[model samples]
Target: MSKAPNNQWWRGGVIYQIYPRSFADSNGDGVGDLPGITARLQHVADLGADALWLSPIFKSPMKDFGYDVSDYCDIDPMFGTLEDFRTLVQHAHALGLKVMIDQVLSHTSDQHPWFAQSRASRDNPRADWYVWADAKDDGNPPNNWLSVFGGSAWQWDTRRRQYYLHNFLSSQPDLNFHNPEVVRALLETVKFWLDLGVDGYRLDTAPFYFHDQQLRDNPGRGKATSGDAAFPDVNPYTWQRHIYDKERPENIGFLQQLRALVDQYPDTTMVGEIGTDDSIATMAEYTRGDDRLHMAYSFDLLGADWSSPFLHNLLQRFADKSRGGWPSWALSNHDVPRVGSRWGGPDCNPKLLRLAAVLQMTLRGSPCLYQGDELGLPEAEVAYEDLQDPYGITMWPEFKGRDGCRTPMPWDSTAVDLGFGNHSPKAWLPITGAYRKLAVNLQQRDPDSMLHFYRQLLHWRRSQPVLIKGEQSLLPVHPQVLAYVREHAGERVLCALNFSDRPATLNLPTGLQAAAVLDLPGLQGGRLQGGELAFEAFGGLLLSLA
Candidate 1:
């Protein structure tokens, strides 16, 4: 008999994030579609992921890819029809893997009917649906708000003879969430997806849903801090405190409303993306109770800080502030550089990849694994001519953009295009030669491959209830080594990871009886001698302690 479904499945679940355009291409159209995702569902289920979170697939103008939605209720023809989506959901359900989709609720493509109508004339029915403000006497923007994509956040509209707010590209306008009508309209759209059988949602730009009602000028940061080193320092978005622009307290009420709507559906969940000055605090606030988001994630783990102190401090800080909240941790995604290249640099070995997998899986929160990370695929080299990300295009040499991480997934080493799609069709983004050796077929045959290690790690994690739902306590160890203990229901496991590329030794906590050393390939297991534990370079071990 099958096991009963748990409504709180997301609490300690593992979610695999799929970038639709790069996952798999069906219909021989050189683009990944719903049918392709449905066909690839087995791979995810086999990988031990409890859920799959798909990026946006709504009707779009392709300005910022699918982030600029032109229609919320329909699927983009490039992706497929509504029926295709329903079929994908059905297939996922059959495999016991829940399906979640990205919901871009902050803004819409300028081509959206509402935006078009609002820009036509101020007297239109949808005029107040979007944020609009009057230009200053000197014909300048009303405030000092800056767009994330560069330039002022306000764009001029000749039809309305006023400036409109756009926190991103000029083609994408921010919605007026203060308006009750706008909030209701967005809720109706959310209901449409819920009715379509999606298990949950990954709220894109969740913190940007509401802006300061007074439209106050934001204060500026003195200089670039170490925290701002995550992305390229080409834009001014990172130079401000961003207090008035995002993470406004008023947004909490809207989140409550959203939570209420999702509560109407059983076994439904929502995970928000929180990016702001104090993202960790914001994550805690958004998920403080069941009245808002079920879980939230920040860019703390996704940044370039891979040191033992950095990781330990971040986890400890979240634990201190989380109270009863939940967090979702991700190492690599479509937005940033791949972890293999980011943390490992040029010499990112298979051992480091295995270590990363072990650390993420053993973390106390829900983990989100991005596509191709299981194969240890590094950032692909997208030449200047092939660059697609607008952020990279604008910032050129200083920041190469996110195109490197958004390349198509490699399936077959011998097949052209690596079996991502038909060989005859040209992919939206090229699959470079560097990923050929890391193809799925190639890795499947190698027991020591990163793919195999990831599979083993995830499967092993599922069997350890203490690692999944236990309370985590940081243990003292060498500065280059991270050690922690997870305990639940009288079961305790000690997890130790060496952050450096050199062997390290540390003394284990006393009064713990070692039961067995977890089996992991490509690295030496820890040996306890006179209460001292020794580990090899990039080695990780989990010990069952009583």
Candidate 2:
């Protein structure tokens, strides 16, 4: 099938993130596959998402799930064949949903042929394909760079008598982007997917593409102060400033190369996953111009802060530093606890979930909604016995790992394994009883369900061009209320959200008039009296302004 005509559909678009393993299991193999995803395109389309971003499905050893790629050009058997992937793309496009696959270009599985050959001998043609450095005089790692998954980033290899760099698992070795051949080869792999009519790529660990070439020791800033927000405070990775290990200057040129390649295809784009101490700054740098990334997102919103000031400052910082660059906002994904659990607390109800959905959809950038988030699925509780993520396993009780968020999607509340698969052969991650109660089948029948609310919000958002491409300006409001004005082509919308659990009143900023109140869930019975907007707990209002 021919590609969908390019219209830069990503700008202000809603991209749904689907963790393949949890989305649907077609063959009852207890894993989600390409055919399964293909079969489920209707749900995404019906959800009003403009595109779907699939996590890694490339051939892998399954370490780090599919993030460790053994073969970039092929599909892993667990997911399905390359033909199945093609069928998925075709079907998704047919349903008017763009397909974006995750590309782990910074590293590859140790089992990858290139890594194997690189580690074989010093004189091998591919010896320089991966980062290989000599050990220090004391036979220790070349530097103090730490792996994100824990321990030293350098792993010793006997054959080459050298240590290779891996920002993640030892099995996932970092590729040497300094080698032009390596960059060329990775781009070729990317082109292979584009040739198959894939819409774009979600570049994983994007800022880690290049490292400090001099191999300087990463200067410690007392404690490891910066790490993934999803990680527990106990993981020491957060204490370091991470100067030498990632977000190096050389990465920009590589991104430009990747962007140039994708730009060759119509409407193709790239959204980078940037995790750094100053991710907003790096996000701006990576996407500052049209020559670099099409868009980028950091873990800023994915953290625990849900207050108005926090959200306001986060958006303001991005707007100030991005220098006209676009951003993609996400509240939850496979790597973190679900937002409902993170922000809603133990007693989180539908009112809070609906408020979150409204806030996320009306944000100033393209929004990515994780699978099951539309159903307001809280983070599942995964016991140690059922844990599958290595990062979570390394930290155990202190962290409890990411498996809580990676559980299989519950399709049917009453079906076996929550109707994830036909036979529901022991799922890779068990479905929790709480999650089963929020199953799609059940929510589909409820008009007030979070899922239905998301559909309504997205459909409404699409109709408002101002919401799609507006310039955002923060409005002065009470500390507990988040209010902002989005204006485009003379159309303006005042979005006010009450973050507290009790009634709050927001005095409209002087000179601003509510022309009409947009129809949104949870806004009924709200009153605008004497130039003051009264909101119940977790209430949200979107006002069309004169």
Predictions in order: lDDT: 0.87, 0.87
Error of 2 at 101 (Å): 0.4
Over 135-161, each residue of candidate 1 has an lDDT whose tens digit, in order, gives 989999899998988889999999999
Number of clashes recorded per candidate: 0, 8
Candidate 2 structure quality by residue, lDDT tens digits, 139-245 = 99999898988889999999989999999999999999999999999999999999999888999999898888899988777665454575457876776778888
Query: Which residue pairs does candidate 2 place in steric collision?
Result: 223-239, 224-238, 224-239, 224-240, 225-238, 225-239, 225-240, 226-238
lDDT of 2: 0.87
